[model samples]
Target chain A: MITLAVDCMGGDHGPDVTLAACRQFLNHHPEARLLLVGRPERLQGFAHERAEVVPASEVVGMDEPVEAALRRKKDSSMRVAILQVKEGRAQAAVSAGNTGALMAIARYLLKTLDGIDRPAIATQIPNMRGGATTVLDLGANVDCTAEHLLQFAIMGSALVSVLNDDPQPRVGLLNVGEEAIKGSEEIKRAGELLRAAAARGDICFHGNVEGNDIFKGAADIVVCDGFVGNVALKTIEGLASMIGGFLKEEFSRNLLTRAAAVVSYPVLAALKRRMDHRRYNGAALLGLRGLVFKSHGSADALAFEQALNRAYDAARNNLLERVRTRVAHAAVLPAAPDMASVPGATPPSPH
Target chain B: MITLAVDCMGGDHGPDVTLAACRQFLNHHPEARLLLVGRPERLQGFAHERAEVVPASEVVGMDEPVEAALRRKKDSSMRVAILQVKEGRAQAAVSAGNTGALMAIARYLLKTLDGIDRPAIATQIPNMRGGATTVLDLGANVDCTAEHLLQFAIMGSALVSVLNDDPQPRVGLLNVGEEAIKGSEEIKRAGELLRAAAARGDICFHGNVEGNDIFKGAADIVVCDGFVGNVALKTIEGLASMIGGFLKEEFSRNLLTRAAAVVSYPVLAALKRRMDHRRYNGAALLGLRGLVFKSHGSADALAFEQALNRAYDAARNNLLERVRTRVAHAAVLPAAPDMASVPGATPPSPH
Candidate 1:
């Protein structure tokens, strides 16, 4: 049976959402067991045949500084859940806590895989093709070198391969323009690195793609630094929500339009289901030594369940082994000199 | 009466769209005159009392490099249109040609205003509040320093003030996060410069805003580096189109949905009208000594006419004079140390 560690005292709703999600998740996956990490009193009376509470005294507030959470809260639920992954007590860990604190503790406790400079957050976004496009470095490392991007591409490719069952998933480097000469120097250098890696049969690089290409499903996987990815992701969310609001207002404009809304209810409902971001929750923190998935901090019970199911699937599919093997193969290739000389070139120390 | 220079042989449809737009634009504004610049052979037989064909020998291809179009094609229609603005033959110049080529020529000929290091591209985007937000540095100056962003904020605020009739428009610096400690070193430093400018009463700074805030109408003016701004703008365009395609597919699904589509046609049309990007055409190239506006390369006759109307309005309202006055006032503030040391800190060499 695959086991998953849950940060029960995390996210906006905390135990209210996480615990309810756990109940639903358990009903769906009979073979999966949960190691619920949180304060004993908060998680009390959670009686499931496959579930056990791992009590922790502290909880990391969503707005707390990463340093304070990391240094001061040693026994915090978020950290303890991640520790379960480090100790092999669980195959994967899931959290909807403070992203900064979660990433810091995961990096410090689980550490990064060999040949990976920094772990990147990868999440799925809805695309025009009806399927989803996986985008990486959501908000983990802000200032990334070309080498870090290359690593993200490799890791992202591996994740997509396992999830989509595509042997050679297409990888596109996100830039301002599709042309090679369009973006900043770092992006140009990363393009060269990605091309070289593609030559080694590491990935199928689909050249450069613009921001819109992400939603157009131009490539199976889109790679970018955290800053750009974060901004792009949030922009998509905002635009989608705004469009939704406009649609509602338009439908309710008058009696005729309101009646029209009723006649077209199924079409609108289907559209809503297709565009619902909650279905695509759970961003994987790839390149880590252990498996970790982060759900949105404000995720509802249904969304939290999706995150839990994603973690269970990753653990069952041996995603950690797959990432390790691909990264090992990629590391054997000759490193580009320009990528090696980037200022923050220190290798990540493995825990 | 205001005379506007038009690049007739620009954009994908060339004279087909521009000439038709000119005919319609002239009908709407009786006091306005157009100096249509293009090859004589292509401009033949188009006669209007308010429109005069100014012969040009060459045309810049949509995909031509900036250097080739600037130096090699000196007599290009795009160049001749801007030449009219520089020579005081027209109050403003409008082009639907190659953006890179147009910006390079405009900068080379008209140059920048006093104390402005780089000219930025500013365009209006529909917001949730039924109004539009002005975003600057759409794709002109990619690698921007803190000082360049400060100039963009001042210029964007000035544009919004004239266009939206808000004397003190709120300006927001776009970043990955709203927190002061978030984003790259350059963005953090830019925040300081923006805050200092706000203190000096140069602008009504709204502090840092995320990408979603652009659509949420959090501020009247959003300032960002060209790279990020371009990416965000294109991403929004791509998403809007994708959403459009999705809605069409949903409404046309089978016979029942198709029947419902007919009933809901009015609501859909209203939504489409509100979300129509064509209504928001014409990106102003700000900080130039002479006024210049860019139409999308693929704009149709109606869209191109909207750009012409925008140019006419700017000229009629004396946007250039307003921008000049605001920038001059901002230059008197004590410049931040970090902004002062940015590379390429030389004062603009005005025409």
Candidate 2:
């Protein structure tokens, strides 16, 4: 039986919404068990047949610093959820909590693979083709060296291999243009690394892709620095919201537009479904020692249930295990940072 | 009488499309005169009654380097068009041909206005409310400093004031978020500079705005590095294309949807007109000592005509003179760049 650990004290809805989702997921997967980590009293009212409570006394607010949260709130449910995966008690962990906290805890507790510097968070986003494209480092390591980007490419490509049975997942470096000469120093260097890696037959790197290329499905996986990745991800969400509001505003403008709106309701519904923000839930924190997923902070119970199902798949697939084996064998591990350098270290470049 | 310089060899469609647009524009405004600059023989057959042929011996292909094109193709129509603006023979110059060549020749011939380091291109894009917002530095500059961004804000604000009739144009620095601190080093620095500039009551700098904020008309002018600005512009255009394609695809899915599409045709038509790309044809290259405009390379005759009309407006408004006075009174001129450090200099940053 698979045991999925969850952080009940994370996200906007926190314990209540997360608890409801846990119950619903348990109902669906009768053989699955949950290790719900949070304050025992706060979770006392929730009763589920296949779930057990893990006593964690503290909570990390959405605004708390990731490292500070992990340090000061040692007993926080967020850290406990990830700790379950590290200690061999659970196969996978999921949280709709603070993303930075999940990543810090995952990397610190579970540890990175032999050749990985900083792990990345990879998510599948809806595309125009009704299919989805994978994007990595949505908020993992904001300052990445070219070499770190190379590792991200390898790890992200591995996730794509697991997601789609497509042979040799096509990879692309996210850039302002398709040219090799475009983008900043970091991106230009990363492009050369990816090109060299693609030639080596590790992954099919598909050259540079622009912001517009994401929706066009130019490649299977798009890799970027967490800063650019975060901006692109949020931009997509914000655009969907803007489009939704416009459609609603237009559809309600007097009798003529109203009549058109009624006739087009079914078509609009289908399009909206294809564009729904709730459909894609779990983003895996790749390159760590064990499985960890980050869900949306604003998610409700339904979205949380979707995350639970994702946790099950992530556990079954053994994503982190595959990443470790592939990266460890294909690339040489650079010397680890000294203890002093670790604290002030930004992500090293793949260059 | 308004004398507008037309680059007959400037656009993708070349002489044929330009000739048709000039003829149509002349029908609307009898006082308008076009000094159509290109190969005289090539344009002989298509010349309009109100247009006179100006001889030019060369053409700059879209792929040519900016500097080489200016030097080698000095006799080209694109160069001649700018010369018209510089020599005061024509009030304004318009081109739909090569962007780099146009900018190269314009800058080299007309030079920079007092206190401006780099000029920027501003496009009037359709917003959610059926109106438009002016976005700047579309592709004119790639790398930018904080001070350069401040200049863009001022120039974009001035354009909106003259063209958009917004007396106090609210400027927003395009960032990942609205928080002053939530952006890259350049944006963060630009924020402080903008705030200081705004405090003086010269221009209203609203603060940091995100990509989502563009279509929502969150600010009258959206400013950023040329690289980000270019990507954002293309991304928005790409989304419009995807949404349009999706709408059409869904409308043809089944008999029910087809019938609904028919019923909704009029409404869709109205919306399409309001969002029509042709209506917003010309993008002004701001911060120049002379008036210059770039039309869409793929623009049709109607769109091309609008480009000419836009040039007419800029010349009539005395854009260069106004910009000089504005900077002289309220804006600070940045120090000239130290030529030693310049390598593959993208756009100069507004610092």
Candidate 3:
């Protein structure tokens, strides 16, 4: 049976949203088991044959400082959930808690894989091709060198390969333009490194792609530093939210428009389904020694269940082994500082 | 009278679009006069009392290399249009031509303004507050220092002040988070510089904002390096296009959906008109000695006319003087190398 650890007392809704999702997730995946980690009082009511409650004393606040969560909240539900993965009791762990705190705890517990300097957040954004394009470093490692970018590309490739079941997924270096000479010096150098990796058969480099290319489905995987990736991701969220608000206002302005909205409900619903964020809720924290998935902090039960589904799939597919294999094959990666030895390394910024 | 030069032979539609836009623009603004620059053969057929034909021997192709457009096409329509502005015959210039070529030619001819290291493209994105937020460095300087970012904030303030008539526009430094400690070193330094500028009463600083803040209308102006700005801009375009395509597909799937589309036509049209990119076509190339506005290459007559309207507005409101006043008053800006003396400066990449 595939086992997953759940941070039950996490996210905006805490036990209310996560417990409901866990019950639904357990019902759907018959061969899967869950270790529900949270305050014993909160999770006592959630009892399932395939699920067991793992007691934790504290909960990480949505706006808690990373340092405080990492150093002070040693018994946080977020940490206890990841500890399951480190202890080999669970194949994967999923959380909807403070992103920075989660990443720090995951890194501290699982450490990073060999040849991987930083663990990146990989998520999917729906594209025009009726499929989602995988993008990496969504909000981890804000300042990245060319080597870091190259590593992101490799990690993204491995993740996409498993998600799409494609042995060789195409990777695109996110840049200002398609030309090699375009973008910052770091991006240009990353492009050269990616091309070299392609020559060595470590990745299938699709050259440089613009931000719009992420939605255009220009490549299966698009990689960039955390800052740009975060901006692009949030920009998409903002525009989509604006469009939603505009549609609602337009359809409710008058009696005639209200009737029109009723008539157009089916088409509008289809559009909404196509662009639903919940369907793409899970964000994999790749390059860590253990698999961890993050759900949006404000996710409902349905979205939280999607995150559980992703972690389950990643575990079953042996995603960590795939990443290790890809990183090992690519000999261009430079040696990185031992993160475990650096006690005061900068904490990751929240997504 | 507000006199503007038109690159009539530029963009994909060339005279077919620009000439038609010129005629319509003249009818709308009685006080505006246009200097239409293009080959004589194309200009001979059109005549207007307020608009004069200026002869240019060549046109810059959209995909032509920046170096070729700069060195080989001296008398190109794009060049002639800017020449009118340089010669004091016109207050501003408008083009729907090759972006990189236009920027290179404009910079080489007009030179950078004192205290400005690079020219940036500033444009508006529709925001949730039923207005628009002005963003700068859309696709100019790929790499930017804290000083360059501060310069962009000042330049953006001047542009928005003219566009909105707000004497003190609030400027936000775009970053991953609103927290002061959240982004890259450059972004952090930029935040500090912006705060310093605010203390000196040079700008109204709104602290750090995320990409969503652009649409949230959290600030009147948002500043970032060109790479991030370009990515944000193109990502918006791509998503908008995708949504448009999806709506069309959903509304045409079957007879039932088709009837529903007919019923919802008015509401749908309202949404389309609100989000139409044509209304926001003109992007001002700021930090130049003279005002130059860029329209989308594929713009139709209506969109091209909007570009003319922007240039006229900027000229009439004395945008250059406002920029000069802001830059001169700000004591933090470091002196830039004389662009005129740098004979072999790198050409701008295409927007």
Candidate 4:
């Protein structure tokens, strides 16, 4: 059975969405089993023979402090859920609760990968391209150096390889330009280190990609500091919402436009499904010793189901081991300066 | 006549798109005067009398170092065009040249405002609301502190008021959450400072906004550091391209889908126009002592025309003066802090 731990009391929608999602996951994957950790009352209604309820009366609210909240609420559903992963009681953990809380408990419980100083929250973002781009450290580490960014690249590369099933994932350093000297002193230095590593022919290094490349999948793995990653993630979110708003305005502009949407409904529906956050809900807290997925707080059942799929894939792939091995190997290896000549480095380093 | 300087020797597309854009601008706005700056030999044939030729024998290529190119090539179109802005020969300068060169010149000539450490490239990004959202620091300072972010918030708000004609345009700190405490320590510090500023009514503050807010037009102005801003900008570019790819793939799915696109062309056209970067080509170097505009390096003639309009607006509105006046006023005569809550604790503290 693909066992998963569910943070039943996490998220804005809380138990309602979590319960529905668990049921949905079970329905879709008969092999999937859940250890629902939350207030028994919340996880009680939909008691499945295959799903067991772990009593946890507390939760860290969306607004609570990360450190204090985690410490104060030892029995909080989010923490209890993480503990399941810590104890190896479940292969993966999923939470839609406070992200800070999730990250903290996951770190405190599961511990960081052997050499990782920090564990980054790895999430799939809708890129300017057709596929979702994986950007890490979206929140986990606020202040990061070049060495940390290098580790993120290694872990991210491994995650992308497993998730996308790409034998050699192309990794790009997220920056303002493709030029080596572009950005801050740190980013410039990071670029050099990344190039040095890429030269060894260990991982695919696609050089520098800008914000536009995030969505374009210019590289399977885009690494940056948390601040930039957070901004990029939000920017993509802002753009998606902006486009959604425009479509709504356009379709509502006139009866003709609305009629046009009906005729184009199939294509539009397909497009929406292709871009839907629900279909791409789970974000991996990469570099962790175990798998922990942070779902959007407002995620509905469909999104939760998607999270389950991601968790399952993650568990089956032994993602943690892959990341751990790659990171360990990358840490000791010499720099690969030769990857600068990656076939696609010219006018369009758009990422 | 509205005289606008065009850097014919700039951008990947160079004079081909640059000349076409200039001629088109002149054709559309007969009263508008065009000063094409480039190699006299290359520009003389295409520009004729409608657009006067400004002899610039050298050009800045995409591959060359921005500073090196600017320093070595005294007669380069990029330098000459910016020089025109400095000399007051042109009300505004337009360049598809090196962004680094334009920013350097603009900063060196225009100088930053008294309280402004760095000027930012502010652009109106297309949102889902069918209207545009103004995001700043598209490419300006690569590294910024919390204090710098505060300045961006202030400047971004003023730009929105002038550009969108909104009364006290709501300003949001681009972050991963709507909560005041949802980002890096820097962002949190910035958020606290923003909250404090908002309490004092410095500018309309709307707490934190996520990436989706960019498209949703959640706020009139979204403020961030240059590093984050660059990532966000490129990410949006990536998303736009990705959507284009998705549409292309979806429409090519089958013969029936192709036929449907024919019927759906009008709606698609309207949506595409709303999202087009050409309409928002002009990027004002905000916080500068004087007004400066940066066009897309690959900008065609249509894009150049839009840039001209942005420049004219900045010039006519005395945008630089307005920003200066507002900052001077806000910084001066410190308004009473939010003393309504506490009578004992003084607000005067150290940064």
* The candidate that achieves the highest TM-score relative to the unseen native structure: 3
- Residue A234 lDDT, candidate 3, scale 0-100: 94
- What is the TM-score (0 to 1) of candidate 2? 0.89
Cα lDDT tens digits, model 3, B92-140, are: 9999998888998999898878888888999899998988999988877
* TM-scores for every predicted model: 0.94, 0.89, 0.97, 0.86
DockQ, candidate 2, vs. native dimer: 0.32
- Model 2 over residues B1-351: C-alpha lDDT tens digits? 889999988777898898889888888888888898999888888646778888889988866665678778779889998898899989889998778678778888998877788888898877776677788877677667888888888888888878876777999998755656455566677898889888887689988877667778888898876766766666566666777778888889999999989988777776677668899999998888888999998888999999998888777777667667666655554554522124434432111
lDDT of 1 at B326: 94
C-alpha displacement of A217 in model 2, angstroms?
1.1
TM-score of 4: 0.86
TM-score of predicted chain A against the true chain A, for each candidate: 0.94, 0.92, 0.97, 0.91
Residue A176's lDDT in candidate 1: 69
Identify the superior model by TM-score, candidate 2 or candidate 4: 2
lDDT of 1 at B257: 97
DockQ (Cα-based) for each candidate: 0.47, 0.32, 0.61, 0.37
- Using DockQ as the yardstick, the better of models 2 and 3 is 3
What is the Cα-based lDDT of residue A62 in candidate 2? 77
Model 1, A61: alpha-carbon shift in Å? 1.5
Best candidate per lDDT, number?
3
CA RMSD of all predictions:
4.1, 4.0, 2.0, 8.3
Q: For residue A333, what is the lDDT in candidate 4?
A: 43
